[model samples]
Target: MSVLRINVILFGIGNIGSALINQVLESQQFFREKRNIDLRFPIITNSTLAFFEKEGVKNAWEANFDQLAIPFTIEGIIEFAQNKGLENVIAVDATASSELVKHYIPLIQNGFNIVAVNQNANVLHIDFYKEIRRNLKKFDKTFLYETNIEAGIPVLKLISDLYYSGEKITKIRGVFSDSLSYVFNRFSSEDVPFSKILNDAEKRGLLKKDFRDELSGVEVAKKLLVLARELGKNTEFLDIKISSLFYDDLEGTNLKSKFYFDADILDKYLEIAKITQVKNEVLRYVGEISIADEKLEVKLISEPITSAIGQLKGSETVFEIYTESHGNVPIIVHGDSSRKKTTTIARGILTDILKVAEKIKIKETVWL
Candidate 1:
């Protein structure tokens, strides 16, 4: 059996990052034996430091990172690849940092495909989004970031297929955030304070370090924008009307320094839950995209406990795709990505890598 070597340069050695590395390393034998592919991680980076080795990491990447990783920059990473004559390079961005997004164009230009687990690059200004796609085409590189929407769900590909197949998709709607799903599900069912659920979600790593980040609804809105764009809509992220669960309520909370734990602020959610309960409805944070009109929204909405969106439990995310053919019965794609978020995300990343690898294999066969 012949083996095809593909190099992976990983960024962000945080939770998801570490999980992906372990998954890749552990599954090496399986990939090699079954798929005839060898994935090599020549570089693994945190925000500032990186572990670089030509032969790729082994079972001791953690120790290697701790003992041998050195400070590095994006330029240094690019130069390292260029000097090493690396090909079939896939750059994995597992960071939540917006600053790291600026390097994506450079990496693509320097012969690197992208597999981003972050939303920053995909939900940037419309011009930059177009530019990135344009660069991908011009450079003949693939960019896949299915983890941005819902890691275990195939909604992105579903939307893309429906759009390309000439389906008249009128709307795409559902609970898009696992964190928000977990937050709202508990708030609606439990009589406990909303802060308790929020605090618990934060501890479980379902939320950003700052709980308000997920509650702002921007993350979910960005996800909506991503899907809309995938379905051929030119909607900008700013155009989406985000019905925030937290940002507007706080007196002095911006994104950077937002960590409000006031009892008064959390009371509104409790009140909403109680008031909605009288009507036999529960609250859910959801995103909806109307392709016929190109309108997008992310907000806290009320649904019957029996309804699909409302029935979502603890960190479950669902996506419903509406089309002319489907009529009353929309295609529902649901997942519980938050149950094992990091592992699911790691699987998603590997799936994307295989997509690229499959393409390379096809190209090689055609050439031969």
Candidate 2:
């Protein structure tokens, strides 16, 4: 029996990170017995502090908080991993920090595989993306980020598989925000205030306090950037225009004002519905990149029921990928409509990584 163990370094021990740790611990036995793979959570770190154990990390490390002592800096993490003489190290970033990208290149150069759940790194400047790719090529390591986009949706794999099979994607469009979807879906039914729905969502842990990223369409823009990159199109987040539903002054408002304010763009849509004769005037933030003329459009769509985006429900993200051979086909990916769903997507990425790792013969690619 081969007792092979893979050491994993996890960053950001927040809600998403905690869920991922739990899933890893729960599946350890099954993974070891079935796949001959023993996963070890040796180094766990956050922005403030870190904890290291050669033996597997405790599942409830976060609950204890102070007892587990380790260094916190980026250098500290790298030094600890190196000193341990860890053969196989994987860095999982769930923080959504752009700074994490700066750390990944060196880690990969040292032959550590990086799997980032932080979409910021992948979605930002094309130069950064090219640099990361260059580093991956130099070190002969894998850089997989399946969880950066849709949670628990194998959207990346689906696109890659199709592309590899010689399918040409002509146009891509989607409804890609759980928070916005939840807000709009509720707005359509109850005639409730947009701010009220947002407040409710925040209290329920469905939306963040400052949900500008999700509501402003920046989150969806990142997803589209990743998709465009994979399809051999060099694109950046700024290159794609985003239609924001959030008010510029939203950051200044207190929780009390959020319920009373009519600053949100969705509020205008609702007001229009009340006064105008427009039926089923639903609001959806959409991102599209068409290959025909290489045109990219990102805007909030408010149209009739028969329109492509007039029927979005709570936290359900629908994607349409138009290819030369497949034509227009819709792929619907749904989630829990909460922060917890982000963790689910993180877990899904881990699952996909494991599957990919299992397929690569160590003997053939001794460098990996």
Candidate 3:
């Protein structure tokens, strides 16, 4: 057996970050015994403060961070890693901050492979996207970010595999947003007011963005752009045409309020639901790109209730992939959309870490 040591510098101590720490602590032993993988977190950080764990995190990691974390800059992190002589370093980004993305290139240059749970880093300006890829190649470092879209559903990897195999992908479409999926899924089948379900999801910490923001379809569009770029499309973010679920007249009202009063918003969603119901269809916010037309779309469409996308429950997501080999039968993927999503998402991030570890072969052989 060979033992591999994986060191992770985790960013973002919010929901996903905290969950990842818990997962690492809980699974550290299993990986060591079963896989010969010694995974450790030597450093952890949020947006403003960082904690340097000399011996890796313990169960009391949260308490230690409260007592020992200090304000930090990217320069300080690089210096600390250098001074400690940490090897086989991987930086895991679990934050949604665009500013944090500015440091990705620097970290990669400083001998770090990146495992991102962040989407902005992939969907930013196309030039930056290309530049990051160039740097990764130049440094001979691996970058894995399966959780960037579909909450770790492996949809991006599927697309990449098909494209790399010389298969022509005709189109890819799905209900991409978990928050929006839950809201619309409920609205389509139940008689409850949309505002009630929206607020309830917020109370349960299910709404990652404000419910209204999910209605704008910007996040779903970003997912589409990332997938498009994966297909070697020279596409810009602005190139995708977005159709907001909310009408144009309501845009101003949404901007003025963090979560605008929504009794009326309920009416709009209900009206659309009624239209879909009459045709034996259900409302779904879908993102689709037809490569033949060279255009991307994010909009609301009516799907047959018996269809794969329509059968979604809670925040579950599905993808319908169309490729030249499959003809009319598209590959359908179901997301790991458990209501307790932090655990599943953290596991996804951990899977990416193992990918980097296995790829770089930072291992020592031993006879057992």
> Which parts of model 1 are misplaced by more than 4 Å?
54-59, 247-249, 254-261, 268-273, 276-278
- Work out candidate 2's RMSD over C-alphas: 3.3
**What number of backbone clashes does candidate 1 have, counting pairs of residues 3 or more apart or in separate chains?**
0
How many clashes in each structure?
0, 0, 0
- TM-score, candidate 2, is 0.87
User: What TM-score, computed on C-alpha atoms, does each candidate reach?
Assistant: 0.92, 0.87, 0.92
lDDT by residue for model 1 (134-192), tens: 99999989999988887897678778888898998989899987888887788887877
Off by over 4 Å in 3: 55-59, 253-262, 269-273, 276-278, 362-368
Residue-by-residue lDDT tens digits, candidate 3, 266-305? 4766676566464768888899999999989998888888
Residue 206 in model 3: lDDT = 76
Q: Residue 60's C-alpha lDDT in candidate 1? A: 85
At residue 39, candidate 3 shows an lDDT of 89
Superposition error at 276 for model 1 (Å) = 4.6
lDDT of 2 by residue, 259-283 (tens): 3454555477656754464665766
| Best of the two (1, 2) by TM-score | 1
